[model samples]
Target chain A: MTLVLFVQHLANGLITGGLYALVAIGLSLIYGVLRIINFAHGEIFAVGAYVGFFLWRVLGVPLPLAFVGAMVGTAAMGVAAERLVFRPLRFADPLNSMISAIGLSFLLQNLILQVGGAEPRRLDPFMSGVLLVGPIALPLQYLFILGLAGVLIAAIEVYLRRAWNGLALRASSQDLGTAALMGVSIDRLARVTFAAASALAAAAGVLVGSVFLLQPTMGVSMAAKCFVVVILGGVGNLPGAIVGGLVLGVAESLAVAYVSTALRDVVAFVVLIVALLFRPQGLLRGA
Target chain B: MLALDRVTAVYTGRAVLHEVSLRVAPGEIVAMIGANGSGKSTTLKVITGGLRPVGGQVLLDGEPLEALAPEAVVGRGIALVPEGRRVFPRLTVVENLRIGAYSRADRNRYREDAARVFELFPVLAQRARQEAGTLSGGEQQMLAIGRALMARPRWLLLDEPSLGLAPKVIDVVWDAIQKINADGLAVLLVEQKAFAALQLAARAYVLENGRIVAEGPSATLAADPRVKQAYLSF
Candidate 1:
């Protein structure tokens, strides 16, 4: 293959990799704090996409505002999930929560199907045209995804490092009982964590919807890939999720480029199997 | 006063604490000495609202402290330095201290309290930016106690401060506890090491099988023949 072709795939890889990182980071935060895997996380993404779609297409809101609205909408959804499903089940069997999340996942998907209909809808791209440099041509939409994702990821890192609530979240993840002793409002933090996680997932949904089909079922595969990313990054590890998302994204992009386009989704399963078999401790150190 | 009046605690299906009564008056150091599984930590759990009591009242100055979350307990001016020196390992020393001040309604005292913590354990100031996990065991214990002090607590409850530490380290911790108590903050020091516990406190309670077997002034309990034969023999 030509070097130009390789570079195009690399850019494409980064674009999709950025989206995966966004979703995985949310999954990691929720799992890190609560020690619960939200199977409905992908469905939260679908909710975000639809929220954005509704705001922009139906209400004629601006695209950027639509993105913000989607985040807010999904954050509320996260809070509800925390208060209604996760919190009551906090002391219950972890399996019960997972099953509850699965139930939530199915419920959201069907609700979307009922409201939006089974037909796939398209979210118009905010920018048209490509950025040309030497032999490399990157679509402006893809570049927007890369830049926005970078900004969002950096913001999350800074918050975790510098913010009061963020430090409490990190501390609670390490030792919940000690955090309680320190006067951390565990229930409040859990709700906040859930809202933040949902918001991040929703942001991903909006970003992906900009350039791809906004289908009710799109989150199913995207979430499976995010699960792979979370596993690769180490469960509940933030930095791991970032790295794992990019790795999976690039691996899938290369698979599509060098192998077959059909293998793009299957690559995540392969990576999941390999990661589980070889490094179940995760690729990072946190959890 | 911080008091447990006929407190009963159950773990799983078994009652671990049965009608156990104890009290710590303002600015008084009260020691609770017990063997392993004698419900020493359970008492802390109930006081902090980690375990909801099946019976009895936990009172802070005669205000009911039942069903309150651990954060509310701290707001009411009581804090616990739990066993095992559980400093949030990945967080830096300063971050751990900040968490201690999280529930403070008076936002202004945080810096003052933090300065006092650093004074109490100067090594913590030296390791301010380092992650807690990288510190030695002794330093971790100091950080744990220092972390609690950041809240400007009126009553500090310690659970086995001497667990897995050298004698020298224990001395440093005890010295800090005495200094903290001298500052007019009440301390309820729980320990398996009766020698240090009895020496530091004005009064002591002996816990056995989740019941208060004997309690009196520290000197009186220290001289008791039953206390010498059973507890101090260790």
Candidate 2:
């Protein structure tokens, strides 16, 4: 019984961590490129999950199909947000931009609530069953999420390292005005970054929905966790988010196993504070 | 060939450039000289499409520039090496150059242009992978000009290329600017260092408090009493 409980909780934690890393990496990418925190990012994730859920429920689409749709759909939303909201506010005060983000976040959440209602929404398991390896049993869904997250991170890395558009994004992020002088459209690159980041968040949200309960207000908690992950990893650091997520996940699992189940959320926050205390910038921060 | 036709520009409803018109013919180096707040930089901003002109027009090859975006202005073969050497601090030297070709569509042509920049500034070739922010100020300035060159612009707008450089380094930078102009790229040079600018440009404009106070052949302007009194501090 003890062994089974430990494995089950570990699986849960790893799956959750995978999703957290996805969202955090997205946040970091946007920060790296735009020099803006994108406070509406988590809401974009929430929007993705809702879209995936509705697609599954109404269209009876398969999980993979719905995931793709949710990602593309949320990416479009991000692009539109960039075009309509952030772009107009580009030269405005940074604080005003942040406030606008908060406003947009709340507006998006309430809109979801209006459409989906206050009732908690959950998706029936899109994939089930466990693989028993000797004394340990692992859920296949955990492996799927982890695998997808790995691919996404790798793809982004390759793009940044080699692709033309990626090169432009990297340049623009360092100095937007100079980048413009270089003929790089800082505005268009920003729009692309926001779109890609939002899509990634949405994909993670959709995946997490299959493994956890979903609600319109779910984004607030996830958004907070994504911030913690980015902070723990160091803002604008990509690989740090992955390592930080895994560390947080394992810590959470151990706390749940050795301490108390109700203390799991407390464990994550405590880990964050302790991490910040030791290295204010983050664990992987070069400074 | 780039020309500003009675162009006026404002910031926050206050005029910064009042009907200031200037021109740089193909392969010519034209300098605009003024003290701080004399609207020298403002003229470059309007020419580069960084700021819109409220009155008249900015023309490149006889076409109105008011309809174009800044990036579109680059597409029309005008590149601004902005003041202060605003190189992307976090990007690699090579990455900075690559972005100069952002408006360009031909990848092969871009590669050739980058090679040409490397030939012009071999130091950048040596530090291609180094971050721009980490480079010495002179190196950063070189990277900035190299970045502008990567766009293969026919009209290059340079703002204060000698602002904060050692005399020897300024010579190197000025030589590179001259070399770029000699290679058939017309130049609009803005400078606070009146002597070096006057020596380099064939024609020059003197701006004072947001208006063109004088314009002539560089020799004539340098000999003018007002330019000698106000700008030449020797």
Candidate 3:
């Protein structure tokens, strides 16, 4: 392939990676503070897409308002999942929580299938077309995804650094017992973290609906890819998730460019295996 | 005042603290001394709401403390500088201190409290922007205490403040403990260093196999033959 083609693929992959980071960051945050790999996280993404679809397509709400609605809706759903499902298992084994999350994922997927039907839904973009930059033409929605993802991720970093609740969240992730002793309410933090992370997943869902065919099972591949990103980044490490997502995205994009679209999805798995075998601690060590 | 009456903490169905009882009055320094796995830490856990007691009660000024959640316990005015100086490893020192004030109602007083912490340990001020993990053991210890102080707790519970420190570092910590106690913050110190613990504390409890085996004034415990044989042998 030409250098121009390679750069084009690289840019596209990075855009895809931005979306993946949105999903994986939530996964990482939940694990960072809650220490549970939320199996149902992908479902939250799908739910976000559906919420956005209903608001924008059906409810006639504006696209931006639909995005907000999706985030709010999914955030509430996440808190409900936490309260009804995970919170009850707080004292239970970590294995039990994982199992519960897996169970919850299936339940949510099927529930969405029942509610929304099996047809693949589509979301027409509010604005479309591409920006021609020299030799490479970049889609506006893709740029939107990358820019928004960057903003959201950076916002999280700033919050964790500067905000009181955000600071407490980080502290809680480090040491739950001590965080509680210092007056960081475990219950409240769990709810808030779950909500914030779920909202990111929802936002990604809205973006996904803009470009991809949305179905009940969309979260399966998305969540799996995100897990790959999480594993690649290192579990519970924020920076790792971001880098891992980007790396996986670029790898997939390049594989599709050189090999075939058949190998596109498999790239994340390949990266996951390599990461686990070589540097299971992750590409980045600490947060 | 904080009181534990026949509190028993079970870990995986085995009692770590079997009917452990203790008391710390206002503005007093109380020490609980024990060997490893002797339930000194468990006793603190009971007080801090980390581990719920299977039996008995923990009272804070006659209010039931054990019934409350861990964070609720903090709101009720107790803070723990947990063992291992569990300052968030990746967070900056200022962030750690600010997080310590997570339970404090007066957000405006955070700056004032942080200033006081910096006054107590000027090292923390210099390292305010530094991640907590980078701090030396003594500095981390100071940060842990400072973090606890940010809560402006009625009672400060310290677990092994000198766990892994040089003699000089321990001296600095010991001085701070005295200074805080002098400043009228009640302290419940759990330490393996029985000698120094007794010296700093006004009243002390000797824990053995999850039970309070001995209790007396610091001087009396220091002089007790059995206490000396068991704990103060060093």
Candidate 4:
């Protein structure tokens, strides 16, 4: 591949990788606290994109406002889901929770399909422009996505590092029962973690939706990518997720350019499997 | 002050605590001494709000604690340094201390309390940036106790703090507990280490198979013929 094309693909990969990190971070946080892999996580991401699309279409809200709305609204839905479904199942077996989450995922997907139809809906970018650097071209929208992800990740990292609530969250992840005895409100922490994760997924969805068409099934692909990132990053390790995402993103982008566009998703999975085979804990660390 | 009035609890329909009653008055150290399955830890769980009592009430300052959540119960000034020295393994010593103050929103006092915890557990202060999991068992126990103290609780509920530590470490921990009580925080200590627990407590209760078999002044209970023959067999 030409150097120009490779550089172009690298930019594309980093943006996608950053988004993957955002999504995986949420998944890791929820899994950390509740110890259940939320099957509906992808659907939550999809719902976020839909929310952003609808807000832009029906309410004529600005892109920024719609993005926030989508995140907040999805987070609200996440909180409601935790309260109505997951919270009740706390005493139930972990397998039961996993099943319930899967059921919820299908339920949300069908609900969206029934209401919005199966058509791939388009959302115009709020700004359409291109920037050119030495032998490389960049889209302003891609830069926005990267910037947004950076700010959000930075904010979350700060809160997790400095806040008491963040410490409680970490403690819950380490051991739920022990955390409770230490005076952490486990239920509340679970809800908040769910909400935060949902919100991140929502934001990622909205950012990506502006660039790509939104469909009910769009989340499945990202979900697959997110899983790859999670595996590559390692379970319960946040930094690993970020690194995994970027690695997957860059690898996938390069494969699309140098190898074949059709092998784009394949590259990520292969990398993930290899990462698992070599370092099952992940590329960075383990829980 | 904390009081458990006929508190009963069950896990998965099998009862673990049956009508367990205990009390820790302000500034006093109360110990629950028993064998492995004697419901001492369950009693601590009941008081800490980790397990809701199936029957009767947990009262803090005469208010029924059954209605409050675990963290809220902490907000009401009760903290439990649970069994097994359950310090957050991945967290640094300082982070563990900060988490202890989860119920407090006052930033200024939180800093002061953290400094005080460091003062109490100087080892923790030395390893403030170290991950808690890497510490030795005795050090982890100190961190757990230090973490509980960061809450600035009126009543500190310690479940078997000296369970796995050596006698010297136990002495170090008990000294800290005694110093904590001297600083006016009431303590509810549950331990299978009957002799060490009784030495620290003002009043002590003997638990057997989920029931309190005897209750008296710490020294008297420690000297009881039954206690002497059973738990304190030295």
Best by TM-score: 1
Candidate 3's displacement at residue B26, Å, is 1.6
Answer with 1 or 2, whichever has the higher TM-score. Answer: 1
lDDT of 2 by residue, B68-149 (tens): 7676788888888889989888778877777778778775467688788889889888998998888998998898898888
Candidate 1 lDDT by residue in tens digits, A156-235: 99999877788889999998988887878888889889888888899999888888888999889988899999989988
Considering every candidate listed, which one attains the maximal DockQ?
1
What are the lDDT scores of the predictions, listed in order? 0.90, 0.84, 0.90, 0.85
TM-score of 2: 0.90
- Cα RMSD of all models vs. native, in order, equals 1.7, 3.0, 2.2, 2.3
The DockQ-based CAPRI class assigned to model 3 is high
Question: How should the candidates be ordered by TM-score, best one leading?
Answer: 1, 3, 4, 2
Q: Estimate the TM-score of every prediction.
A: 0.97, 0.90, 0.94, 0.93
State the lDDT at A133 in candidate 4: 84
Model 3 score (lDDT): 0.90
lDDT of 4 by residue, A1-287 (tens): 37788788889999999999899899888887788788889899999999998898889988789999999999999999999889989988999899999899989999889877899987777577888886577988899889989999988888788766777788888887777766677778878898999999999888888888788987788888888888888887888888888999899888988889999879977997788789997887844
lDDT of 1 by residue, B1-234 (tens): 999999988999899999999999989999999899999999998999899999999999999998898778888888889999899989889888888888787744677877888999999999999999999999999999988888888999999999999999999999999999999999999999997899999999999999999999999999999998888986
> Each candidate: how many clashes?
0, 0, 1, 0
Q: Which candidate, 2 or 3, would have the higher DockQ against the true structure? A: 3
Question: DockQ, per-model, please?
Answer: 0.83, 0.56, 0.81, 0.67
